[model samples]
Target: MATTTDKVLNRKIVEKARKMKSYAYASDDPEISDFSHPSVINIADTVQVGISTGGSSPAMARKIKIKTESFLKKNISSEDIYQIKLQKFARIEAKQVLSTQLDRKKFLYGVMNDKRVKGLLKEGKYKMAQGRVKKMLRKLT
Candidate 1:
């Protein structure tokens, strides 16, 4: 149970361990195992969203992480992840302010459709987009 410098072998070892229901942590060196190590990517997040693809198809999982990193970026460029972040922030802020469930849902869904917000996002003016979104969210608070 020594850590192998070979990445492919490490992945295989991790995969095997995953089948044991001791699934979450993969030890590099069992003798001095440190399962508490932080993974660069959040496996829980991907799993919750079905991104791990687990045994379904790792290649597909890789493609999902590689291809569309930005929200709905399968239709856009990879560099557009920033806009997605802005949108996510806007959504969380809106949710915090809007009280009624229906109103919050509608506002969040329509945020992207608003001409000002959309235009700001399209222009990559994240600051302006955030400001605009905050102003809008304040109205519902």
Candidate 2:
């Protein structure tokens, strides 16, 4: 088997790892991060927001990772996935509705920051948030 170091440093592997890390960082799936730290946090599947110093400062990375985990636990809800999904669906839907790149960008921005959606997300009401997003999309289109 390829050693952990070998796997992480290879360019293609790094790219794949980064994508996997992004998902773990964003999920509430309950898993450990791929860090070499002794005290790894099994925080989204939700911790470490993909902060790497490219082999320069592992300690700093861990510090930031732990801090982020704490911050999320304090401020962000693990189930607040509505915004993430909305962005994805909206991007595809916007292509059908929006005629210009600028219009799509503006529409996405408005959807991202809508307070009602944020409130729904924080409360873990993803279905309600999705419903609101569909309404928003309809209104905008």
Candidate 3:
């Protein structure tokens, strides 16, 4: 019997891959969810937070994650995202008037720092914030 040797079998990359570590975790019940030792917080389907113990206690990581997630969920709302989206659109419109990216960014920075706009956003009044941005944009035009 004769065996054939492949030229690609001598590659260093293949050897390194074979020696790499593998990890897996599973939960017994499908209804119940499990979090990794380094727990994570998922926000608005866009942002995520990860807590790691740095090879310490998993329990501590989980506790910290719960507190942090709860606080963020309480503070951050859809209205905040809506205000951001409104600003993004305003930026596109501002580009035509501002002439340069740097000018647009500077204008946006000033708008964001405006006291009235800040108060409206803090109060979760996205509609008012949008109006404020429109008024500011009108000034630029």
Candidate 4:
């Protein structure tokens, strides 16, 4: 007879395995879920294999070191970082325009005057153009 805890754990492991098996390996669908739980048997098998192979591997450690070094070497500049942040916030504000009658012109002028948004425009992210049009609606309402 299985204990309550043992039954719960088995159910969790089976559910996770099912979820993992449901998705394609190279899926482009962003909504897919990925979850997997290793069982005790799986852990024992891996340990036995490792013992037979002899000696632990450093491949993962080396890969992480190389990735860290590469990231430090190609770090984004302050201006680029600012531009990315502005683009994100601008997208949020643009979405809000559909729900509110905020003065579009004033809102846009407000955004243009904002240091972050101005930096985004200078970087040539034309998506902000929508915010400008929304500003016009703000004026009419």
Candidate 5:
């Protein structure tokens, strides 16, 4: 009763289902079709072992604590953690550079109008500005 296109599509779906079934269970297990139930248990066991082994470093622990505290304070989820880390680092670095009085007007103007400096800043090359700024600041001071 099916058309040629319908038959072809049905055949493709059957083949995909067969492949999925085969992949979901070991060759020796004929009764098991889904591994999700066992996979969850395995995941719990792995997490328990990892926690018991003290697998994290001090630096990693500190970073995690700081991230957790910041997330609690700001109501951020884990998905946004990397962006938060980058923003925090950038803010600290910018504050340090600004504290040094490295020609704020020139730097801002250059960043706004100069293609090369803007490109470098966009690429997060603050160190490149450090030496140049130091020299210019020395001249001004």
Candidate 6:
């Protein structure tokens, strides 16, 4: 049962969201709105991982999200993000160069699974792999 205060708060939130040209639904369920918090943007700057409490507990979800974000921020680097973007571009170009899906997958698999590329990546030498991927793509085009 919602108390009088809860009802009032819900009304206020609905009004605010409406005035802001948005829609609002009242939910005490944690998982449904955990990422809607402003601090989520800060967390996303490093990495994004979803935590779900299945609408049972918000406190536990918040704690888990904090720990997960801290771990990701410590482990993930800007270079890793850059490498992901580079691979995305390479895949897009490969789609045009390689006619068949199998050929595209095989070419990308070989590029990514190359011993030199793996070694360079393990050594935190993303730029080396970036160069190699771009060069290979250039040769294909």
The best candidate by TM-score is: 6
RMSD of each: 8.2, 10.1, 11.1, 14.8, 17.5, 5.6
Better of 2 and 6 by TM-score: 6
* Model 5 misplaced stretches (Cα beyond 4 Å): 1-115
lDDT of each residue in 44-110, candidate 4, tens digit only: 1221111111112234434544555445436544444444454455546655654453544345446
Candidate 3: regions farther than 4 A off = 1-39, 45-47, 52-63, 74-83, 122-124
- Model 1: weakest 10-residue lDDT segment is 39-48
* Candidate 1 lDDT score at position 6: 69
Clashes of each: 0, 3, 0, 6, 0, 0
* Runs with alpha carbons beyond 4 Å of true place in candidate 2: 1-48, 78-80
| Descending-lDDT candidate ranking | 3, 2, 6, 1, 4, 5
State every prediction's TM-score relative to the real structure.
Answer: 0.49, 0.53, 0.49, 0.29, 0.20, 0.57
Tell me the tens digit of each residue's lDDT in model 3 across 29-95.
Answer: 1121122345779887656878976535667788899889989999877656655666786687788
| Colliding residue pairs in candidate 3 | none
For residue 112, model 1's alpha carbon misses the true position, in angstroms, by 0.7
- Candidates' lDDT values, in order? 0.59, 0.63, 0.65, 0.43, 0.40, 0.63
List the pairs of residues colliding in candidate 4: 102-138, 103-138, 104-134, 104-135, 104-138, 105-135
Evaluate model 6: give its lDDT: 0.63
Q: Which pairs clash in model 1?
A: none
After superposition, candidate 4 runs with Cα above 4 Å error: 1-58, 61-65, 68-75, 98-141
Question: Taking the tens digit of each residue's C-alpha lDDT, what string does model 2 give over 13-123?
Answer: 445657665422211111233433233454454343566554455677778778876776676455444566668777888899889999999988987888988888788
lDDT of 1 by residue, 1-141 (tens): 325786567666666766674544333333223243321233223222235543344566667765445443344442245456766787688667777778877877666677887777778787887888788777766
lDDT of 5 by residue, 29-138 (tens): 22332321111111212221111113224345445555555445455433233333333444444454566545554544443354543454556665664444344435
Give me candidate 6's TM-score against the actual structure.
0.57
Which stretch of 10 consecutive residues in model 2 shows the poorest summed lDDT? Answer: 23-32
Is 1 or 5 the stronger prediction by TM-score?
1
Please report how far candidate 2 places residue 25 from its true position, in Å: 24
